[model samples]
Target: MTVILERDCVIAGGGPAGMVLGYLLARSGLRVSVLEKHADFFRDFRGDTVHPSTVTVLRELGLRDRFLQLPVNRLRTLDLVVDDHRLRLVDFSTLPAPETFLVLAPQWDFLNFLGAEGAAFEGFDLRMNTDATGLIIEGDVVRGLRATGPDGDLEIRATLTVAADGRASTLRDAAGLVPEELGVPIDVLWFGLPKPTDPPPPTIAYASPRGMVITIDRGDRYQSGMVVKKGGLDALKQEGLPALRKHISDSATVLATVVEALTDWDQIKLLSVQINRLEKWHRPGFIAIGDAAHAMSPVFGVGVNYAVQDAVALSNAIAGDLAAGTAPEATLAAVQARRMGPVRKMQRVQRFAHGRLARATAGQHLAPRWAIGLLRASLPVTRRFLTRFIGLGFLPEHVDRPVR
Candidate 1:
């Protein structure tokens, strides 16, 4: 027997976007159901960055202090090694005091924290192990969604449906809303290496003629990612794991000794990079946000933050309308309007970074030495721009109405 349910809003994907949206809308006194396909939030190599923009949202929600209580690494600056010159690219310290640095926590821990907080609201329903398989559309209007839950098939009819299901969104596909692929030239291979007893300075990335490697400090282990040309992982594997190890070691000498920990090919995980966005974000009773709406690159680790921002913008835009049982297509389009500018700007930045990375992965320097020297000379100006650009992002959204 199919179980029928109804809510003010039904959100697919309990990621940063859906979870935050659910929390926000529920707190706004709107009945919200969030569907998570997974029983638990334990996905590894996911975006773990809780940027300053997100911190402000947390502050608005009165969860900032509690969020800080979690085990997290505070990154003060983003240091990048371009060839032989190590550049302090972005300095979060320059931002406003107290909540200046970027927070790096396990994505699962963040999601769990959010889920727990959202549970406090009477209207928030987070359904675990529930896969939102298809949209319930009736005559060009998305009525709700059909899901396969722990028991059996479930039907959730809602006033407004949100597809936050991620880049490969089932709902987005079902709605026939395709994202325009903004070509990305590089993909990343994620793996962990044992941290040395006397670790190197917390350098975030290293780029040279060899390739680009990201090094994240995770207490005992270095959560690392090696950037490769898009669709080049198979060739990299054909070259053997030893070649992979050597390439990593050569790019970032700090990992030379630790690269031995990667003895097997299975240790590496490939993240196929993509930058894409939907031209039209809404139909009649539905809208898409987060990765479902626009997939971002991992350039500045803004994926999580941007998704959260989307939720903030979305909730602020339509929480009232949703609570009143009518979030018209115009209001949904307005949410997209409020967010589309930032998304487009950031995607441009990501695409530019992708071009540079693509060239670097092909044994080319990121930029001319003169350009690097010029940037170094203009540190004061560049650092401030980067701090705001990466930390707060463009047109950062805030929670508008008081939570019920």
Candidate 2:
């Protein structure tokens, strides 16, 4: 059976970006509906580190105190380690206002929290387990979306449609949008380890043979990730667990001391992180945000944070335009223009960082006898290099100043 629903905005994919956008738009008195394919938010091992820039935005939205109260770990500094040498990057302790640091929390929990808060708003509607299948277009503008809900196929008409779906976004594909590849060659092996009784410093360790090991602390556990060349996991697995253990042990002292063998291989996940930017972010009344618009490599871990920022920017821009009685198409185009520069800059940085790491040769080997020694020697320079890549030194002026 076919049903029809209408709203001011229809946001597909109830991830961080979509949920936050819904919350903001609903708060502004616009009828907003968020369609999520999942029955609930219980995914695992997503981007968990909420950076300082994101925290600043959350505070501006009045969600910081409640967000901090959740089960999350506070990360003040990012320690960069290469064969034992370490450099502390962006000391949040030194940053002004709420101490700019990465707040650690599961992505699903955060999304759930935002969704519930959005529900309290007067015009917010959440439809879980409903999948958007296609677009509803009239002339050059997108009039709404065609979706499949529990009842059956339905048509949802909205003034604007937002695609916040992840990397393999169906909406983007359906809209005939293709991403421009930046050619990132690294693939990552991710796994969660038991929360350490006494966690080591928050660090990223790079080794000669084992590639890069990124360690993030969950409130009660630790999540570790290793990046290797594309199609590297098969070769690593062929080397077996003993070889893997030895490789990690040799590369990072912290991991060597803390990591234990888990009987289940299912505990480990492998992801291919790609860096790409869409040719265009909007068409008529429809727009794309988050991974759908620009998917960045995991090197800097700013993907989710940037997505949330996009949501904030889009919501504020559109809300302002609506209040002024501007045309929806004109408003969306303006928002895209405002956001395109920052998104492009971030993609460029990701491409550069991924290239450097992927193309590193033995000639560039900076490892010293002591792992800490190598880190100390390389980290200062690396910290400076990373400041730009991590969306710190070059934050967009519009993002730095909220539209209040």
Candidate 3:
């Protein structure tokens, strides 16, 4: 038998974005349901860096302490290198509140925490192992969603529908929202390295002649990622472990001492990097957040952070509208108006950074040296840049105004 559920908001995809939005909306007393296709988030080598700016928002929600209690590595500084020279850029020590550093934790753990928090709220309902299939629309307005589950197809009617399904969002495609490609091509080679007895400094190492290696401490151990050219993973795989290891050894000083073997290759995971922005982020009563709306390259590692911030912005906007008894259409417009500028700015910044790093030969040759100099040259500027990436810059008067 098929089930029919009704709610105020139906959020498709139970990632960090959906979960956080669910928590916030539910806390505001709105009936919210989150439908996630995956039963669990135990994926490997996913995004794990949570910046302090996000931590500040978590603190506002009273989840900061709980977040800190989770298994995580606190990184206070970012290390950049080209050739033999190394520079510490964007040291978290200079930033205020929740610590200026980034917290390293398994992405699953963070999402799990959000899910748990959402579940505890009286107005929140999360449906796992359920997939949203299509929109329930009437006259160009999204009124609900159709989903598939164990029993069969289910219909969920809500005032609003939110798509947070990730880079390849089914809902976004079904709704026919086209994403604009930013044209920056970069990929990542991700893997886990055994914990060293004497740990090296927490750092993001850019190897000259092309390649980026980020070493993140995961409490008892460390995880690392090397950035490679787009569609470059196949070539690396063909060249095999010796060549890959040699590449890492030659470019990165921190990774030089890390022993490599063919067995280690088995444990590494790879992902292609892309930056995408939707032509429009909102419809009549349907909207998108996170990667569905804007997928940034992984250069800055702000993907999750920005997604969480988006959730916060949307939740706050919706809450304000609901409080004023605004219509669903009006609320959606308000949300878009509040979010579009920041989202656009974020996309532009990501594009710039990705472009600087996307150069095949020249970038690979000059990146490390340039990065070292850039970081070493200006401490204040680096701190401000990191702050901006984390969503802590001046807002326009319109975005700053409280929803009325």
Q: Against the unseen true structure, what C-alpha lDDT does each candidate score?
A: 0.91, 0.74, 0.74
lDDT of each residue in 290-352, candidate 2, tens digit only: 898988677677878778878877887787564453437766677667767877877776777
TM-score, one value per model = 0.98, 0.89, 0.90
By lDDT: ranked, best first: 1, 2, 3
lDDT of 2 at 404: 53
Using TM-score, give the best candidate's number.
1
Q: What stretches of model 2 exceed 4 Å from their correct place? A: 195-198, 322-327, 359-393, 396-404
Candidate ordering by TM-score (highest first): 1, 3, 2
Cα lDDT of model 3 overall?
0.74
Tell me the TM-score of model 3: 0.90
**Candidate 1: stretches off by over 4 Å:** 402-404
Query: In model 1, what is the error at residue 82, expressed in angstroms?
Result: 1.1
Q: Which candidate is the best by lDDT?
A: 1
Candidate 1's displacement at residue 329, Å, is 1.1
| 10 residues in a row with least lDDT, candidate 1 | 395-404
> What CA root-mean-square deviation does each model show from the true structure?
1.3, 3.4, 3.4
TM-score of model 2 relative to the true fold?
Answer: 0.89
